[model samples]
Target: MAKKLGLKQKYQMMTRGLGWDTTYQSMDKVYPFDKFEGIKVHDWDAWEDPFRLTMDSYWKLQAEKERKLYAVIDSFAQNNGHLGISDPRYLNAVKLFIQGVSPLEYMAHRHFAHVARNIRGIGPAVAAQMQSLDELRHAQTQIHTISHYNKFFDGIHEWRHMHDRVWYLSVPKSFFDDAVTAGPFEFLTAISFSFEYLLTNLLFVPFMSGAAYNGDLATVTFGFSAQSDESRHMTLGLEVIKFLLEQDEANVPIIQRWLDKWFWRGYRLLTLVAMMMDYLLPKKIMSWQEAWEMYYEEAGGALFQDLARYGIKEPMSAAVARKEKNRLSSEAWAIFYQYTHAAAFHTWDIDEEHKAWLAEKYPETFDKLYRPRLDFWEKEAAAGRRFYNNALPQLCTVCQIPMGFTEPDDPTTICFRESEYKGEHYHFCSDGCKGIFDNEPEKYVQSWLPVHQIFQGNCGGASVEDVLKWYRMNLGADNLDFSGSPEDKFWSEWHRTASRAEAAE
Candidate 1:
């Protein structure tokens, strides 16, 4: 036999063997999507495999992980891990995950599969194929992990249905929808580069840490399972960017524009995570402002500096986002508080204890700006007049967020950016969103705005109640304040009965 193959040699030989130039058809025909976006690649062979993982070895490693992961899941379920959480309110964050975030994993699966088929190089295509499988596994594992909570929780049961049509959910849904609809190169830049590389810690770390801090053993276990795959995906993100930049000098500006567009897009999409970290998790990991500073401000600053060698500067929205971080979570939470009557998950009416936390975390803004607003709502709730705004708010033509974000300079005034597309005036939440719309007016104009759809009699009916019914959400059980909801009452009753049993024993 020939000399036993070493690891790198095995990887190169095996990966290269996976793809061959088509005999019956030219590569232009086989990989039609490679050139349409104007991403010039002179040689497909230039793509260096980031990780040397073969399919057979990948399956074996993943199988072992799955076995360990399920054992932990079974143990958690048998131990009634749902009851062991820091608080019932903490599950609202979990509800948000299942409802808004988990479904994106499945979408990644579909599109990565598409990328694998359409990319020219064997190295990158094989990498994409593995990531597609990784995404599918993540989606399945998240459902299985969170399904334990569904037995007791109200909002999670209809995640897939709600992800497709719910008003607030359309934020993430639209983000991915735009990505998947783009050409393959743009998809890689958007999801793999911008999302997975630049902004993933903002999404993943906080959620995982919140689970651990909140006594969520099951979800923590799932996080442990996904850590390796997330690293691999992030590595692929960097590799894809560097590889594209090295291929052609002209691809630099094209890639830079994509970086700009997607940074803002990914930032807007992460508004949910900001709200979750600040408002939803009772035992908070860190304030959203702090996390942003640590993750994006410092870490991302360093990343962009590295890319400067390739003439890739930081995104245009970086300074704007840094300014808005001081205000992001507060504004996002305020919208949820106002619209909690129609929301699938419950939001608490901010009490003094919670207000104190907000004050401490957001000293500069909370006391001056957001505190008085919460005090008004708190006083109303105490006077048997809880404020609940059920009316649909105007949505940005691009980001789909309620038109609530304020000027970067002035936190008190609503920041509105407007553009006229083909004689029709459209609105945006920020310069970033307006810029996105200005670039692709045709695509942005066709956005499936839920508020607009509600007006046009498309989403179940004319009223919020009818729309909620169409969303398959139980009105009282799912919506309104978490403090005195049925879930809260049941938690107290269950614990009291358990206490009595222990006392007798």
Candidate 2:
């Protein structure tokens, strides 16, 4: 009997060999999106497949991961893993992941499938097809993994509804929405190259390692299951850039512009993650600045040096993000602290330990710039007058975050930038956001700013309670300070019961 074909042969047969030139329609008509972005692809044949992952092998590998993931999840749940976390506050980080990041996984699945169908190259099509599946699986596993917490937690119960309607969640929703709505190349450049490769570590750390450090076994396992595929996606991102850059010299500037825009957009989106790392995690990992230096500065610096051959420099935002790192987490936590009353997640008073952590992590800036406001909040909460910014905040027209971030150069004052576009004035949190708007004013102008929608009386009604109901958030359960929350009471009772049991023993 003849031997079965090897993996490489099967991969080629399944991917490259399956594609054919159209007979009835022109290639341009069939692959119209491939060229409209002004990207010249002289030979799609020159594109290299980053991985020789055939569908048969792909299914087997994913099945194994699913088995391992579910097994760990089962063990964790049956053993009551949620009770083992370092603190209930840690669950807020998990809450942020579900509402903000997990949905993006599903969005990524849709966009990867889009590029798979739309991009002309067979190699990328296969890569994107696999990545689409990876994303879908990631979304599924993340939901299943974190759903275990939903039973024990309040804010986690209504997530998908909250993601679409919540004020803070608009940051991630708008970020992904911008990518998916763009042309094929720009989508790939924004998501694949910029988000997945350039800055994924900054994302993975705060949630994944944070989970492990805090003893949420299900989420930790979920992170482990997704890690290998994330590595592959990272490889594909690099390949996407090389193929585009080396295909034509004209592609250089277009690609560079995308890198800069996405880098900034991604950095802004990560403000939430920065807060998670610094404030939400009960157990500390490296500070956001430490992670940024390792991930973005040193590691990304080496990547840009390699890509410099292809005429790509590190994104202009990298320098700005470098300067903002010290202040990023502190500022982000403050936003959550003030707005926690309106958010799906809970924010607690920053105790002295956490305050000290912030001081140690952000020695130069935290004490002078942020602590005064933080101390005020802590003191006010203790005095029975917890501050909630009752008024709706003005969101940046581009990034869609409340315009709270201060100047990177001058950390004390709010950084504001605006432009007159087609007669309407649009505000931005920073020059980075404003530059993105200036580049594509028409695209951003149509942004569905949630705060504006609420003012326009589109989000259920004008009352805070009415809007929260529309967001499907439980009245007192999901939105509030954590000090006297249901979760807080449950946690305290749990420990008290345990202590009684130990005494009886």
Q: Model 2: per-residue lDDT, tens digit, 1-505?
A: 3479877778788889878888899978998787778988888899888688888899999999899889889998997788889999899998999999999999999989989998878888989999999999999999998888888898888888888889899999999999998899999889888999989998986688998899888888888999999999999999989998999999999999999899999999989988888888889888999999999899899999999998888887677788888888888887888888899899987778888988888889988887888889888888999999888888999899988888878888899899998899999998899999999999998989999999899999989999989999888889889989999999999888777977999
Clash counts for all predictions: 0, 0
Off by over 4 Å in 1: 1-5
User: Candidate 1 residues 1-505, lDDT tens each?
Assistant: 3598878777877787778999799989988888989998888888887778988799999999999999999998897778889889999999999998889999999999999999989899999999999999999999999999999888989999999999999999999999999999999999999999999999999999999999998888888899999999999999999999998999999999899999999999888899999899988899999999999999999999999999999998899998898789999988999898888898877667777988898888988998888888888898988888867898998889999999999999999899997899999999999998998899999999999999999999998889999999998899988878889998998788777977999
In candidate 1, how many Å is residue 187 off? 0.6
Top lDDT hit: 1
Residue pairs with backbone atoms closer than 3 Å in model 1 (clashes): none
Candidate 2 residue pairs in clash (backbone atoms < 3 Å): none
The TM-score of candidate 2 is 0.98
